[model samples]
Target chain A: MPHITIESGKLTDEQKRTLVERLTAVSSEVMKIPPEFYSITIHEIDDASYGIGGKCIDLVKQEYMEKHS
Target chain B: MPHITIESGKLTDEQKRTLVERLTAVSSEVMKIPPEFYSITIHEIDDASYGIGGKCIDLVKQEYMEKHS
Candidate 1:
C-alpha cells in the first residue's frame, strides 16, 4: 500500500478531499494498486513554520505578490 | 520551507517527537538550514489502509513474522 502525506499551508476540507482523491487516483494508476488500498493525509501548517532559503514562506509570498501586483 | 511528511503505522507521542527532532536535525544539517524553520508531520495509518504488491502490509508483516519466528 502507498501512503501519501501532504504538508502545506491551510486547506479547506473540500480541497483536502479533492487532493486525496487525485493523489490516490494518480498513485494507484502509476503503482498498479487499487485505489482503496491507498492512504492519504494532509497536514495544515502555518506559513511562518515553513521556510526556504532562510526566509519564511509568508514573507516570500508577500514579496512575490508585491512584485507581481 | 521544506516540509517533511512521514506516513507509517501508529506511533506514540514520544516516537513522533523523536522522529520530528531527528528529521529536523538531519534535514537542517544536509540542507544548511535552521532546524526551527522546518516543518514535520506524521500520518499514522492503519495497516488495512496500506498495501503493496497487491497485499496489505499487515498481512505481509504477519506472514513474515510467522515464517521467521
Candidate 2:
C-alpha cells in the first residue's frame, strides 16, 4: 500500500478534504489501484516551527510581506 | 529524498523532539545518510479523527478502558 503524506503549513478543513480526494483520485488513476487502498495524511506545522533556508518560516513570511507591502 | 512521516495520536512536545532525534539517529546509522539530511514530520491527529479497524480510535480506547476498569 502506498501512503501519501503532505508536510506543510496549516490547511483549512476544505483544503484537507480536497487534498485527500484529489490525491487519491489522481494516484489511483495512475497506479491502477482502488482509491480506497490509498491513505493520505497531512502534517501541518506553524510557521514559527517550520523553517526554509535555515530561516524560520514565520520570519520568511514576514520578509516577503514587507517586500510586497 | 527519503523523508519520514509519522501519523498517530497527539504527542507531547518532548515526545516529538525525542522522536525526531531518535528516528534520525537510527535511520542515519543504518542508511549511511547524515542525520541532518533526514527529514521527519509527525502528523498528530485527535482520536476522533483517526480510525482503526473501521472504528474511531476514541471509541476503541473507550471500550478498552471500560474493559480494563
Candidate 3:
C-alpha cells in the first residue's frame, strides 16, 4: 500500500487545505486511487528542529530574506 | 511493505548524506526494520515549485527569517 505523508513547517489553514486537495488530486492521477483513500499528513516542524547537513536550514532562510525581509 | 522517502528542500551534499544515514537509522529504530530494506528519497523542490495551500511556503520563509536574519 502506498500511503503518502507530507511533513512541512508551519502553514496557514488555507495552505494546509490546498495541500490536501492537491496531494489527493496528484495521488489519484498518478496512482489511480480515489482522493478519499489517500492520506496526507502535515507536520509543522519548528525552524530549529529542521536542519540540513547538520546545520540549521540556511537555504530556506536565505530565500525568505530575499522575498520577505 | 513500507518504503519511506524523505522529500526535502535543497540540501547540501553533507545534509543529504546525513539524511540518508539518519532516515535509515530512524526507520530501523521506529519500524524495527533494517536500513537496507527502507527506501529514502530526497527531492530538492525549488522555491517556486513547492507551494503550501495556494501560496508558496511563506511560513517556512518566515521561520528562516527569524533564525538567519
Candidate 4:
C-alpha cells in the first residue's frame, strides 16, 4: 500500500483535491497499482510552524513575496 | 535530509508541539543524528477527509464510538 503525506503551506480545498487526484494518477501509473489502492493525505501547515535555515517559513515566504512582487 | 510529516486527527497546539519534540528525540536517538537536524511537520486533518477501507474516518469513528459507548 502506498500512503503519501504532503505537508505544505495553506491551500484551498480545491487545490488539495486536485493534488490528491493528480498525485494518485501519476503514482499509480508509475507503480503499476490501481489508483484506488493509493491513499494520500494533505497536511496544511501554518508557515510559522515550519522552519528552514533557522527562519520560520512564513517569514521566508514574506521575503520571497517582497522580492518577486 | 530527515524530514517527517505526521498526519492525524486534530490536535491542540500544545499537543502538536509536544509531538514534534518527542518525535525528534526518539528519531535522533534511533538514527544517531542530532535532534536539531530533524525537521517535522504535523498535518491535522478533519475526520471526514480521511478514508479507511472505503469509509471515511469520521464514519468509522462514529461506529467505533457507538460500539464502545
Instruction: Please give, for residues B1-69, the per-residue lDDT of candidate 4 as tens digits.
Output: 588777788776556656666777788889888776877776667999989899999999899999999
- The most accurate candidate by lDDT is 4
Give each model a TM-score: 0.50, 0.55, 0.43, 0.52
Q: What is the C-alpha RMSD of each candidate to the true structure, in Å?
A: 10.5, 6.8, 20.7, 7.4
Give per-candidate clash totals.
Answer: 4, 0, 2, 0
lDDT of 3 by residue, B1-69 (tens): 124444444567776666456545643554444656555566666656666556555566777899998
Predicted complex 1: CAPRI docking category:
incorrect
Question: Model 2 chain B — which ten-residue stretch has the worst lDDT?
Answer: B12-21
* Model 4 alpha-carbon miss at residue A44, Å: 4.8
As a whole number from 0 to 100, the lDDT of residue A40 in candidate 3 is 56
The regions of model 3 sitting more than 4 angstroms off are: A58-69, B1-69
lDDT of each: 0.68, 0.75, 0.55, 0.78
Candidate no. 3 TM-score: 0.43
lDDT string, candidate 3, A1-69, tens digits: 234454445667876676556545644554444657455566666666667556555566777799996
Tens digits of per-residue lDDT for model 1, A1-69? 456665666766766666566556644554455889767666677888876788888899899999999
lDDT tens digits, residue span B1-69, model 1: 557666666767866666566656654554456878777666777988877788888899899999999
lDDT of model 3 at position A69: 64
Better of 1 and 2 by TM-score: 2
Reference-based TM-score, model 1: 0.50
TM-score of chain B of each: 0.83, 0.87, 0.70, 0.83
Scanning candidate 1 chain A in windows of ten residues, the lowest lDDT window is A23-32
* Candidates 1 onward: DockQ, in order: 0.14, 0.09, 0.02, 0.15
